[model samples]
Target: MKKTLIAVAVMAASGIAFAASNVTLYGVIEEGVVLEKAKHGDTTVDLRSGFDQGSRWGIKGTEDLGNGYSVGFILEQGFNVDSGDEATSGKAFSREAFMYVNGGFGKLGFGRTGALSFAQSNAILTGWAFGTGYGLSSWTSAIGNNFSRMDNVVSYATPVFDGFSVHAMYSNGLTGDSEKWSDNNHYYGIGVKYQANAIRSSLIFEAADNKGTATADTLVSDVLTENQWNALKQTPAWSTVKDDVVKAGTAKKKALYVINYGFEYNLGSWTPMFAYQFAHQNQGRRTHMFGLSAKADVAGGNVMIGARYLFGKDKATKVGASELSVDGDVRAWNIGAAYVYPLSKRTALKAFAGYADSGKEWKNVEAVGYNGYQVYLGMRHSF
Candidate 1:
């Protein structure tokens, strides 16, 4: 049973790092068998558990604290090896829990990590492989979202020069409500990368905020008035009482912004990737995405392909008093592929597939019943 669940998670991370004398324990365990299909609907099949990656377990500790300093910690989590669930629910090291301090002007951490522009835009659109395009490759759901993993952060990294490096982050939100903390809300990000030798590049920028306001059924769903337009046709329970008077209104701020750019190049065995992303909001929504990936080596192992495109705008709303509007130009396209072989050096065996579509006012409104497809086959190991 997956090596008895990795020997009971390495004996519960060596009994919680037996008093921590530089602990260490790692993990990975993938499971697969998927099928999916959706768009016109009906197909289904399952058994996927972190398909190509992301079934995890982790632990690491450090201590030294001498002139060169040191002190670290990390506890990671992610699961569902078929049905253990908890890919993050009630947080038990949901992904990572941090604490660090290092020297030479680099490394500094706090809690809940990730979000230096989602790890430099997923390592420049996955040139930093794992499960193809960001694990379990399915063309990364057409590259969107991401920029999560943050919860009162405060990170920093730097100490690579010549090959370039930099990262920064911030978060506040701190909801202990000092009268709603302010700065609108809070979150921040910054990134830079270089890597050299085979070329690599990255850039990131992020932001988040959002205050409060607008209620009254969200301003009568965004513009109605005159007693919410005479209580919207007076039926449907007064349109559910103007959406419960716009969810009991009062909140406004809405801020979000992002910018990312990536690049990669190699050769020899081939490698190429590119990325571009933009997402904006202040309350006008906007999105954009573009990606391309490639990897090669063939037969013995390795092969990946990817593509993506997206465009967006959304606000729409409006279902009884009319007024709010926007959604009319969003698009999508995706493609995916994967292969892997190995079977040693920690196991492997893989396959992947993906598809996506949209265009024509985002047919089916995206990922939900949007033209879809997926395929899987898996096995992966690591310890």
Candidate 2:
């Protein structure tokens, strides 16, 4: 009788512990074959992984703390299916590793996390770009999706109320410093989102400062007149003086500011997205970008079309007593369709194709004057 009672007591304790904590393991696998072309380069075919979205596995758990409070944690890692290796070097949990506490007020998290702009604009961007194998090749190559993942972040999100919410985040910059208190690298971001029955919108602002060197400006002139060209060639003494001036201005504290807006509207069978962004850097550069895309529901999947434009200008640079202009623009367009045939609830097969044209002028840029085209067949399974 004594042994029986002890066993029952142990089982009861185990059940109670299980009730207080919950854990789950989840992952996705994606692989595909892609054919790509580059400007002035030969076509190449290769097997690829994570073309649509990165392949990753994650563990998440929550512990009930009683009284409308809970503690949760998540650890996710990205990997390559072909080589069976981690995506990032020297780091296991490269995607996300964070812990948070949630209650009626809001959720506060600490650790490494995605930037607010990335999180807010993902859904809207999906409405325009195929996001796989050169779908938004033009926009992404220049404006870069306006997203980045950062470490040493403290993030907070407010609970949704009346279809509105806000998020803010800050990162402590680079790690490993003898005097960490006076570190010069820091990042700050804030965003607001609104979701209604047919419309969704997000606004994000972010800034970063780091003590580093930047290519301040470049001078390009392919259409100079004969006299102008002659003057440039004859100013040997001026070149030496200008070189000294530029060298003295080399080392600088780099700073960047970004303002982004994204919107999506659903019209039953079709969804359209719009995006606008502006960026300014302390290195005398400015950029403006605009994007638009639409998706229409079709037979087992959807068809998408996306386009983007980027304009960049830099302050004139002095070269041999002459102020040279460095300004350029990039424009891209893409249209693709995907058919999804579902094998099961957690698996799907997709095939897609896209085309993009990007051109740059007066920038002396290399490998940039080609039209990109690609096609891919991919599969994704989640568990």
Candidate 3:
């Protein structure tokens, strides 16, 4: 009877070992040389990492729990190949660290993960063509200050029905905690995607509520240093409206929102894509962006080219009980192209070049516009 019990325990341990054997490890390494020409006419060249794609290593595993139920976990970390440092300081798995359950009821995930809207934008919008690093879509989307990932996330994704699916997520706080529970940043995102044959489309919405307890003085200091403020005070234009500027800063902070839509169609040899975004922030600042791109197979490789336009509307800030109009409208545009040549199934050589105009500086003291150019050549390998 003792030998029988021991045999049963050995079998149970074997089962556990078999389940653990399902775990998989994966990683990508990319390094490149980059040349950047700043808007101020300064040029710099350096050996950069993650030009085509961010370098990362991850481990993942799944276990079936019978009755069609399964559980999985993933831990991914991003690092710089050039400097051999973590992408995010002090964080081990900065890219992704999440556990999930999957079954007939779709999937539910918890912990740190990518926002639904950001995932949609990255996969279906900007990242489809030349990737997000130097893509024009990335430049235009920055107007919304969108975060790619959030911590303490609770997320759900529905099973695909007729090539359509829905996803949603909420984060208690984007990053660090605040002294007061209500003062932390809360994030919400939702998205819908459809993919059928050669056509793909997605719509996503995201928002963040920044509940910080900041005063007018703090806001002013956040925007300008003492030296800059002293210099600005010497200007006649600034001196006349100094009091109003200070009063305008007294307005309470507001939530930010973004709506993004993307569509793509594949036509055998060539695929075309389009994207649009609307962003609002600070109760006054608003922006709109549009993007168009195309990709084609050439010379045993693929080439992607794209352009984007961004427009910022005039802003208004609250001053005490009244509204104060600020002349902060700006317009910008970007154009870029990328090429990828595959050496093998998991290795590629990539090149990219882009130009961007940042439009006029949005300050009462400055009315200057700037533009710049960038080029990168990189190699990427996956394992």
TM-score of the candidate numbered 3? 0.79
The segments of candidate 1 whose C-alpha lies over 4 angstroms from its true place after superposition are: 1-20, 26-35, 40-42, 51-53, 57-59, 66-69, 73-100, 103-106, 109-204, 207-285, 288-328, 331-359, 364-383
In terms of lDDT, which candidate is stronger, 2 or 3?
Answer: 3
Tell me which residue pairs clash in candidate 3.
Answer: none
Which residue runs does candidate 3 get wrong by more than 4 Å?
1-21, 119-128, 135-144, 177-180, 213-252, 314-327, 362-370
Cand. 2 TM to true fold: 0.75
* lDDT: worst 10-residue window of model 1: 212-221
What lDDT tens digits, residue by residue, belong to model 2 across residues 11-31?
A: 477683334266666778989
**TM-score to true structure, per model:** 0.30, 0.75, 0.79
The per-model lDDT (C-alpha) reads: 0.63, 0.61, 0.68
Lowest-sum lDDT 10-residue window in model 3:
361-370
User: In model 3, what lDDT does residue 222 have?
Assistant: 40
User: What tens-digit string does per-residue lDDT give for candidate 1 at 218-302?
Assistant: 3222454333443354557744554334334555535667787777788879788777778877555577877777788997899
**Model 3 residue 352 lDDT?**
87
